[model samples]
Target: MAQLLAEKRDFDFVMWEQFNNEKFLENEKYEAFNKKTCDMILTEARKIAIKEMLPTMAEGDKVGLKFEDGVVTTPECFKPVFDLLKEGEWGNLGVPEVMGGQGAPSFVASAVSEYFMAGRSALSSYVSMGSGAAAMIQLYGTEEQKKKYVKRMVSAEWGGTMLLTEPNAGSDVGALETSAVKNPDGTYSITGNKIFITCGEHDLCSNIIHPVLARIEGAPAGTKGISIFIVPKYFVNDDGSLGDRNDIWCTGIEHKHGIVASATCSMAMGAKGTCIGYLLGNENEGMKIMFNMMNGARMHTGLQGLAYASGAYQLALNYARERVQMRELGQPHDAPPVTIIKHPDVRRNLLWMKSYVNGMRSFYQYMDYQEELSKIADTEEERALADGIFELLTPIIKSYLANRGYEVCVQAVQVFGGAGYTKDYLAEQYMRDCKIASIYEGTCGIQAMDLLGRKMGMQGGKVFMTFLAAIQNTIDEAKGLTELADLGERTQKMLNKLGEVAAHLGKNAMSPQYKTAFAHSLPYLDVMGDTIMAWMNLWRAVTATQKLAAKPKGKDLPFYEGQIKTAEFFIRTVVPTSMGRMDTILDMCSAAIDISDEAFGGL
Candidate 1:
């Protein structure tokens, strides 16, 4: 198989043709960047990803991390690439120039990130967390706080992490028991044990800055009284130099199934009564401050899914084209064996992988564009619309892509046959690595609850209505095109049914059967995801159809034709199943919740 991370042609088509990202150049914030500059940036990023970072992916997974005493050592291959990321300032591309970053547009940064993630998500995690931490500090920290931490974290000179989960608290973050006591020096003495802290303790950087969530001595209980503090592994002096070691220590690291290079450390703080921390934002606002990092982490988790699926698909495609199998279905018995791509079932699996990958890439790029739009919109209403839609779709993007991206990886494995299951092939590793996306940074079930519980009703349901309306507008556009008119009508039916299903779920959620409604929230999210995928595929078909009408030649012809066919495959095949799910959801069955605890059988 080729060492391809993702298809460049598809990337170009999504950004320039589908999104028309050139329009962003007209905005003053993006005026310094033009099409050529953005393309060159992607080119350089791709080079770094493919040549410098890709080699570490397999080594990291195989060799994994080594934890000894109080230190965690990452794979040796990661250090050189980590250095490249810092020296090249690659981690700060999305940060604004005013905040001491490259000031690239969000979509451009997203595209750049996709490449690096495809190369090695474990290594990329180190960069992304540092950037995310710096972003939070830049947003909510005091000027002095920013001065001490932001620049170093942004440049990847120091590492960063968010320590939230304890042995008692995972999804129920409000139930955390970490405590903080105010001290005479205007700092807080913190004590806590945090688990699953990514990049919590790594040798890639000299220092690790932790934004820990803990409750003050006299604060109220639960999430409301929580506070965020800047707890570093080594203290920073006023002169921007290193001070004595802080009390935070990594006692051990988890031996995980995948992404093994990342140090998921079990951290202990104030073991010797010397964990000093400066409060971030204000007391009792930790949830609010920590969410700034959490939300970004969710988005990053979604991208991890997309990257794994993309890399797997590319490998499967290459394998299918080269791996010869049995004779073609309709060929003579004496005929020579054909490549696996010639087989019908293999074709179906490839198409399934293709359509989802295409849809996912487009969906992520759409969100990336919306992030930029929210920032640069001319009016408050415009900004709110962009931001609101992005907000409403966050869980969908995070959960749906995660669940489906894993499915796509499964299909890739199927395409590779027996070889896919072995360590010799990356497909197996991709499967293992992508599984965590659905489980961590908010499980898929938690994301579904967030969607049904809070996001759908935002601003009196206006935001969700707006989201559906945007899909309708695409359906309407597709209806205008002769080639896509049939798919358009079919997709429109799904959209209408989704609205009805939403209403039914909403009614059930508020009434006596609210538990039943919550029981089916995952299914509701699935249907929503399917409908959205159909919408993305249909939109891509419409664009490709229009481009084909212009009579393009060479490779463009097959690519455009493939787009239309992929849409047909999903709409004709997948949407009907989603419709069935919607029907099931409408019934609001209470069986799952009504079952008696004693009736269940266990070992």
Candidate 2:
């Protein structure tokens, strides 16, 4: 409960020294927010998280949402926390100012959200959904639509949910069975059932605005026919007053593995032939419009992973420092029992978790900075390149961090031994909460396919090479530090291997042997993720080294020294493991394809 989201020095290093976020103040859009203002906002958000949200986290999980008589009810403890979030106006930090939003930079918004998420992931669901919905309207909504919904959503007077997944269309969204029929008055009647709708049916807010994907009558089949509609739980009168309830009902609720406090409902729309819906944009462009929300949700999912990992790491570290165990060699029988932190293996695991968690936070923050730059870049070419890099890194950010972050959570539990598996401790819940990050948004396999199959070839490989070049820049900068010289060298080697794999896949994409290349793409993604993370850590180490050298005996000396040690741990221990994956890629293993349907019949 002691707000262990991110260290102050680490956050400052990332914000001022690493990304130089102060430069954004020169732009008119960010001129209203100076470094002091942003820091103040972050501090306030952190306090709200630690005080209001963290206290109810365990209670919310224990007394999760309940569904009966077509209504979903969250735990009693959630109301005050939700009220605190709305009253603080933390929900509207990233929306445009005209719509009652503060228009904060993505970097600051992401950092605040990361802290809250670290405190209570389930409670953070409503805020995340609201922000995603507001972003959709900002990107593609008409002026009237923005005026109608965006303000309410941003202010948290109303909530939002993305209704895309159906019972049969989990991953293959193209196969969605939802349908819509247009009426003479310009409104449409939507009919469908959506499953696993997070924040789908909750009483935390007065209204819930759902962005549903459905196929209009007479439209083409498959993904091209899908359209997005704005369907609210309660209808809004022309005079801007709340009207009668719409016909969207929660038919059931999912008994999920984690985030139990957030209602995951199975909703039936137009079952009573009265679900009125408004089209968001042009017809047959629903997928394109939904991408805006999807991208935001994907980034948030990565942060969710970060949050759980950070929480688990902090808890495990605390436990290791306090829990006593038998002494190792060179200790007398009379010697007092030592804390587990004194063990070499325990230290290794703890350091590994710390290194990866810190590196992931920096990686995610850098992505947020890139997102801000994509919108505020001075030149068209810079904007275009930024957009390209965002596209290429989206899948990596989603898949790599989620997958590896879960690994860290598991390691955190491992550090606790048998005690970690008990419900009496929070580590079990942390592991459960982290599992959903990789599955939702998009599965790791889907992300790997997107990264290797599509993103690698986007814009004729310009984007991919731009990404490689960025990492190369970090490597070049790190070369001057003798401590990181070998890390820089190994990073270059991994990048070269990545390029070779990319070239092989590119050349064989159209050939009969393409399947062989595709078989090992996931491994390639792992290698790529490890390489990029190492590059980020080395860059951090180089900066920390300079700071440590400047003040030989200051209070910050240990902090800087820890940064260097974490970087060395990651580069030396983790990067070497990727060599096996690189070899696996070159071999073009087709074992997955070789397995037949009968082979899995045992399930």
Which number leads on TM-score?
1
Maximum-lDDT candidate: 1
Tens digits of per-residue lDDT for model 2 on 349-435?
A: 999999888888888988877887789898988888888888888888898889888998899999899999887777778788889
The Cα RMSD of model 2 versus the native structure comes to 1.7
Supply the TM-score for candidate 1.
Answer: 0.99
**Root mean square deviation (Cα) for candidate 1:** 1.1
lDDT for each residue of candidate 1 in 232-263, tens digit (9 for 90 to 100): 99999999999999999999999998888988
Estimate every model's Cα lDDT from 0 to 1.
Answer: 0.90, 0.85
TM-score of each: 0.99, 0.97
Cα misplacement distance, residue 245 of candidate 1 (Å): 0.4
Task: Kindly report which residue stretches of model 2 are placed more than 4 angstroms away from their true locations once superposed.
Answer: 1-3, 599-603
Position 82, candidate 2: lDDT? 82
